[model samples]
Target: MDSSKELIKTVDLLLEISSLLMVSGANTNRVNLSIDRFASALHCNTSCFISHKTIVMTVYEDNSTLSCTRVKNIPPYAINFSIISAISKASWTAVEEDWNIDQIAKEIEAIKKQKRYPKLVVLIAVSLAGAGFCNIFSGDYINMGVAFASTFIGLLIFQLTHREGYNVYLRIFSASLIASVLASLGIVFKLGANPETALATSILFLVPGVALINSFTDFLDNNIINGLVRYTTGLMTVLAIALGLFIAMLLFQ
Candidate 1:
């Protein structure tokens, strides 16, 4: 009974560590360090650590050790689920001496094999377009439609690049460029009513408002490094959009 209780406590510790690592966006090496620290904090002789640049975790216990390596590149959501499963298995092992880690791992494998979230990109695109439309000044249907279309195209570009696994920087650049070009075309050709207002609203989707907010939140949380990084990234995103628009105007003239 005491052994079972200890197992449950260890599992709880694992869950806490996993949650912290996930929130911090720690890489595999850092995750391992976190696990080690957590084990020390819990006064547990058992330790779990990950390999550098790999998703493999080596868990050392009193008399035995085990290694669990993810075979494929798992998404963040899947990783979260895996962490939960690991915690559950650890809890179960507390009550059962013959608990099969391999079987538990297989269960995690099965869960991962399930279809991932489809239409996530599509949803994000729709959200961007909607945001752009909302930012527009006019209430007329035609102006709104134009603004929505322009932003939709920009979002579509971002989604396409995202599907190809492009980095965040590239994705931001591509989205900004597309939005600027579309808005510029609308303005230069007089394609829509109140083109200036429409274009301004449409390009608002590419703004870094969320990033700035998060940066401030990070600062409030005393994460200076992360706050600065997020703030800089947000600034860069805004600048990229502005630069794209500027270039488009110069060429359109």
Candidate 2:
């Protein structure tokens, strides 16, 4: 194929890689590194700029004489560390094996389609995490049980709302309100020594810890624009959770 065509194809592939990485919770630095690895493996150079909702990429080859630029709108974000890890490994494999574009694309597609844990298992695990937080906050067994139950039901509501295409903040708010309300039942019945602890920790599962961490990482790496975007998003999510808890308090009181 001609140099121009090859550059275009490479750019398209890079856009796909960037999109997947962005949506799968990769930090900006990680995304840039992955793009570099793939470009080097294919004997090309790339300049990729990532923002909150878009990716702009330019690919150059054959001594920078041939080039192409592409802009891709990032899809909705999801948290899938497995995809991030798989793509990180695949980038190295491409370099070591000298894999062509087709091979790399196939590997990425496979990574995209990797099966997640069963829903029931995920629910149980996340609920256990909430319960663990309650215990860490000095809650007794009763508070832990209430937290576990609230977390399970809240996460179920979150999944259902997400599947129905609800807004992200709305989904989180609903989950927080429901979870806090359920936790409050312990207080109403005097069922636990630390019912307030269960109430406080029930919504811990909704914290945007990864986003907040990535925001600081980006700032440290001099990605100021993306850093600000992520920080704002994390802050708004926190507000949404607080609003839900506030309303739950009013209703239960």
Candidate 3:
């Protein structure tokens, strides 16, 4: 294979890696570092830049040599730590050992397809987390149980809508609306000692806490634009949840 062509292929591969890392919830510095590290392993010079909706990467052997650039538009993806960790580890090893790109790509593909947790387990865990929120707020046992059940159903609705590829805001709004409305059932029927407790805790699953944390982390890392973008996105998510809750409250009131 010609040197230029092989280098271009490596550039394309790095582009894929960057997109995967970005969607998997890696911060800006980590994505750029991984791409540069992987490309350097293959003896190619690399530069990667990230923006709100786009990623651009370039590779060159020297200033005089033919350079290749790839640009990608990425939609947001759910955070999956298993995929992120797998790629980070693979990139580090590739940098250390200069591993074959094909093998690395295969590994990434396998990791991408793997599921770290069963859906049932995730539903149960999310339910427990919501119930935990009730406990944190000093709710009674009846309220905690209502939170548990409401969150379980809300998460189930979210999973279904998410799989259907609805718009992000719509998915969040629908999920919160369903959860809060159902949670209000405890209030209406007097099933729980505190109806307010169920409504409050049910929306815990929809909080944008992780996104806000990432936004602040990016700001600390000096990626101002990305930081602001993430913060704005998190804020919008919170608004969507609030709108959903407002609608539910109106209905149940």
Highest-TM-score candidate: 2
How far residue 129's Cα lies from its native spot in candidate 2, in Å, is 0.7
Which of 1 and 2 is the better model by lDDT?
2
List candidate 2 segments past 4 Å from native: none
Task: Write model 3 residue lDDT over 1-253, tens digit each, in one string.
Answer: 4877777788778888888887878888888888777877777788778976898888888655688888888777678778788888888888887788787777778877887689999999999999999888888888989899889988898899888988988888988998999888888898756779889889989898767888898999999999999999999899999999999999989
Locate the minimum summed-lDDT window of 10 residues in model 1: 69-78
Instruction: Rate residue 124 of model 2 by lDDT.
Output: 100
RMSD for all candidates, in order, please: 8.1, 1.1, 1.8
Error in Å for residue 197 of model 1: 2.3
Q: Residue 168 lDDT in model 2?
A: 96
Ranking by lDDT: 2, 3, 1
Q: Model 3 reaches what TM-score against the true structure?
A: 0.93
Q: In model 3, where do residues sit more than 4 Å from their true spots?
A: none
TM-scores, all models, native as reference? 0.55, 0.97, 0.93
Scored by lDDT, model 2 comes in at 0.93
Give the clashing residue pairs of candidate 3, or none.
Answer: none
User: How does each model score on lDDT?
Assistant: 0.55, 0.93, 0.85
